[model samples]
Structure formats: structure tokens, C-alpha cells
Target: MTHSLEEHGTEREGPLSLQEIDEIIGTENPPLRNLRITYAYHQLAVALARLLDDRNATWCGFGTWASRTAGLFIRGELKPRPVGLPPVPPWVSRHLMTWAAPHVGSNVARGNLLVFQELGPLFHTMVTAYTEEDDAERALERVLQPLRPGLVTEGGQDLLIAAARSYHRAMPLPHSAARSQVILLANLQVALHEQIRLQEAIAASLAPPLRAPFTPAPLNVLATRFWGRLATSHLMDVYMPAVDFTTTRTLIPLRLGRDVGGAHGATTFCEHLTDLIDLELKALLYDFDRSPNSVLGSAAADWSLLAERMNYLTDFFRLWQQDPCLMQAPFTPRQAEDLRAGKMPSGPPL
Candidate 1:
């Protein structure tokens, strides 16, 4: 079922208060709560989208995809909706409510707060700093310091500094506009990281086998997450699209691509693609678990498909992690065009 804020006929000008959020969500019924949480994420995604500048193709592409994907979830369907798949099962809805909804609600609230409260003021300051052409470095350092605290090593600092210097250099934005976009982009990266964590948490919670004893994630996984977060946060033109909530079915033409010229390149590419696929698998497993015959046909066929997909994703993650590339660079226009044409640059086929 769909939930729309417009149904309440209330003005959508500012963030909804806690009481207002509750009223919109209405009952604690599992399915309804799940839908409301989905709606909340949708609102969060839209807020992020609005912050994106069209002059930056990478950021805009990611924002557009994220907003669209969240919109589809509100309808209980994935992008490029499967032809005859039934609605989400009842038990899955219950699981979503129990394991995912609360975190999603809180995260969305946090994201909104960050956008309006923290980032909003910083953005304004950045604009002013740029306009004066003084104290810009100090202003940027203030925004960057909090994102990765102790983890940003000397090398990482160099990357960040380089990123700041070259940020939006290819674009024609004025100084104030460029600086403001940088601030927004940095915070947006942090917010998106929260979204990815929520997705991983939901997947693990729903899939019993994945719920192993809590240990630190493998180094490669940790590395990928770190660099992915850092690149988007500091590099103006670098943006990783939020993970897809479901299968691609048919590959949509991607407008951005990268060249994997060496071992590091291949590792980075796989790390990125694997994260996307893992999230997609989560949605597939949700639909597959205890599904009715009408929804996905026989149990055997469904299990087979799920197993195959999981195995492929697992293999990629394993092999790529062996040679982890902890740094991610922004994509150039030519590299992005190569991706658009489905060229592998130099790595294994995606």
C-alpha cells in the first residue's frame, strides 16, 4: 500500500515534527509501519536530491537514481518492475518492520537534521568564504575533519587536499557555488553511508545464515567502505550511486564508467560493483524467503536463482578483497563514457 503526505493536506515546507511524523505513520501495524518508513526514506532521498547541482553530472546522476529507487520502494516494487511478481509477502513485511523500520526512521530523521541544521549553516559559510577568496581552506578543513576523524592518514590528507584544489575545476560554477556544493557533497556522503549500513543491516537480519557472531568486517570490506566514503566526501566530481534496492533485471545504460587499467583498478571496480549487487540480493532474498508459489513459482526454482546470484556476488567480493585498493578516484568524462558503452576498461566483466 502507498502512503502519501499529501493525503494529510498539510504543508510540506519544513521538516515534520516528531509528533507529526507519528501521526503520518499512524498505526504500529507492521505492514503500515514498513510503508511509512519507506516513505520517510523517500523524503530523505528527495531532500538529498534537491541539494545536488546539475553542473556535476556524477552527483546529479546518483541523486536522481536514489530518489527514483526510493520512489519505487514506496509502491512495493523494484525499478524496472518484474513482469508478474506478486506483492511482498506478509512475513517479509513483518520482518522489515521489526528489523529495519526503526533504524530507517531514525536515520532519515538524522539525515534531515544534518541537511537542515548542520550542513545548511556550513554551506552558507562556505559560500561566504569563497566569495571573499579568503579563509576558504580553513572553512573546508572544518567540514572534512569530522567525516573520517582519526582514520584519515597523511596520504589520505593529500588526496583530500588534491580533491579540494581540483574540485569542479572542469565545471563552470562560480567560486561560491562550487564551495557550497563541496560542503553539501561531503555531508551527503556521510548520510549515504548510513543508508548503505541500514541496507546491510536489514539483509543480515533477514538472512539467518548471514547472522554470524559479530566480528570486524574483513580488511577489504573495511577498506572499500572507507575509501568509498572518503572519495565521495572530498572529491567534487566523484560520486558513488547509492546501492540499488533490487535487481537490475535488464541493465540500464549507465552514463558513468571507469577504466580498470591495473590490479588496483580492477579491485576498486569489483569492490564498488559487489556492494551494489549485495544490496540487490538483499531485496531478492526478502521476496524469496517463505514466498508463495504464485509469487515466484516453485521453491526449488526460486532457491536456485537466489543461490546462483549469491554465489556470484560472494565470489567477486572474495577475490577482489585479496588485492584491495583503498583509494577511489573521480571518474573522467572519457572513462564515464566508456562505462556508458559497457566497456570493461581493463577489469573482469561486471
Candidate 2:
């Protein structure tokens, strides 16, 4: 749906600047900007994966120079288009750029995490190679090269970071009841991580001389702490209900017990109990699946474990509402009276 709303997804010939991003992507809003950033991270991940697979790069050490412009290319370009997944719009330009302020800010936070959590470890694991390394230029190349074939082209990464420079500008919270409500809720959770990067950027930009006893790397450390706090906050805090509210509301189901008389009460009870039991069993299985990886630290490995869990649930829940055999109770007399006469009865199920 968003393919055309973009201006460009190319790499700059030289070091990236924010204006170039605004120009290339027409920095108007969130989705367009996020698409750019997400593309960049996806590219980085692939580049690292390639390095991880390389013999010379085995000891960690990859950087921007390794890759170059390929733009929003996907796995299959020539063959007949695949059937299922929604194709990226042919040109994602237009007012979509307006969504960038918040989207870019959010992804930038995650991008920082990807860099520190994933890339930094590669360096640590392969530190011996890093210590002996000389050509900083080659080091950057080595890092970025593997990503050459993936989704983000060199130009694209440059453009995204460039566009992201305007992130400090706030997304004018829309006055519309629908949009503002979402922003107010999402801001609470998202702000914590986003602030992490800002603090670090400021500290580094103003950091003192050659060797002062460091208090910490400002932005990243704060990011680390903020993430710690986020685990305790409920998911409702982190994402706007409206983001996936349609899907979520469908998944949770509504059972108006009071309205739906006693005739079907036993049926509903059995169904809810069965669904919960199944859910518990699924959770247990995933818990076990993660056990082996507890001691093994690799993104691919961790992703594989989590992916299995995600895939399993995605399928299980997709059909849960339409589940053929599941039983549910019918309406009670008062509920039926309200329904027949047309009254908005309160509670989940009707």
C-alpha cells in the first residue's frame, strides 16, 4: 500500500547528512521514515550475518563501508510475484511522510539496541582481531560488505539516518480524537527508549577530553536502564491499542455472561476453560524451547527460538475465533429483551 509514497531509497555518494534524508524520502511523516530505518536495520543484520558466516571476518568486525546502494529490493524481483504477503507499494510516497517523526524516533532507539546488543558482541568475541586491525577504512568495509546483497542499499542507510536527524521535532499530536488518543498512550512507553539515544548523543557531542574517568556512555546507558524498566510495564503502555486493536479485539473474544442467559452457560464455561488450558500448555512448550538457548547467545539462535513460539501462536490464534467446535452460551431473558428492543448492553460477551 505504501510503495509510491517515497521520494527515494538511494545512498548518498558521501557521508550522510540529515537534509539529504529529508530530500530523498520527503520527510513528511512516520511510516515512510520508519520504512527507511527498518530497511537500514534489516540491511545491517544481513551484513552481520554474512560476516558471521565469513572466514576472515569470523572474529567480529564489520562497518558501513562493507555495503552500498541496492535500495528496497526484496528476495524475488523477477519471478511471478508471490501470493500471500502484501507487496510493498510500488512507490510509497505522499503524506505518509508525516508519520516519520514518531516512527523514526522509535526505530532509532531499537536500531541503537541492535548495534550495541548485536554488533558490539561480535567485536568482543573477536577482539583479538580488532586489536591487531589497522585500516579503519577496511574495517568499515568489512562490516558493511556482507549487507550489500540484502534489502537496504548503501544509499538507503545513509538517507534514513539523514532523514532521522529531524527526529527531535515532535510529531504535532493530532487533535482528532482517534489519533491523539493513540499518541498519548504510545508516548508513555516509547519515550523511555527514545530518550536513551538522545542523552547519549548529547553527552558524546559535548564529551570532555582525551581521558577523563568516564561516568558512562550517556545515551546508551540510559537506554539500557529504560529497557530494564519497560519489562515491568504492561504491553498496553508500549503500543497503542489502536495499532492492532482490530486484530486484538477479535482474538480476546467477548462473552456477555449476564446478557447471555444460563442456557449456554455450561457451554461457554467449557470452551473458555479449554482455551485457557490450551494456552497454558502452549506457553509451557515455549518455555521449554527456550531452555537450551539460555546459555547460547546469538541473535539468530535466539530469534529461531522465539520465532518458533511466534509462528505457533500466530497460527493457533488465527483460527481461534472461527474455531468450529468451540461452544458459547446464548442470551439470557434480560439480555435478549435488551437486544430485541435495541439497547447497548455492557460487558464482553452478548
lDDT minimum window of 10 residues, candidate 2: 232-241
Off by over 4 Å in 1: 1-54, 58-61, 75-135, 151-199, 202-350
Q: How does model 1 score by TM-score?
A: 0.28
- Residue by residue across 65-128, what tens digits does model 1's lDDT show? 3332332333233222112212434454345344433433343333333223332333333333
Colliding residue pairs in candidate 1? 257-336
> For candidate 1, what is the total of clashing residue pairs?
1
Q: What is the lDDT of residue 135 in candidate 2?
A: 55
In TM-score terms, which candidate is top?
1
lDDT of 1: 0.30
Q: Which candidate is the best by lDDT?
A: 1
Tens-digit lDDT track of model 2 for 1-350: 01110111111112222333333244333323323333332233233223222111111111221111111111111121112212223132112222222332343333333333333332322222323457543444443443223112221233222111111111222323232222212221122222232344323222221233565678655543332222111110111011122223222211111111111122221222222323323343344323221212111111112333222222222212112211111223343234223343344422
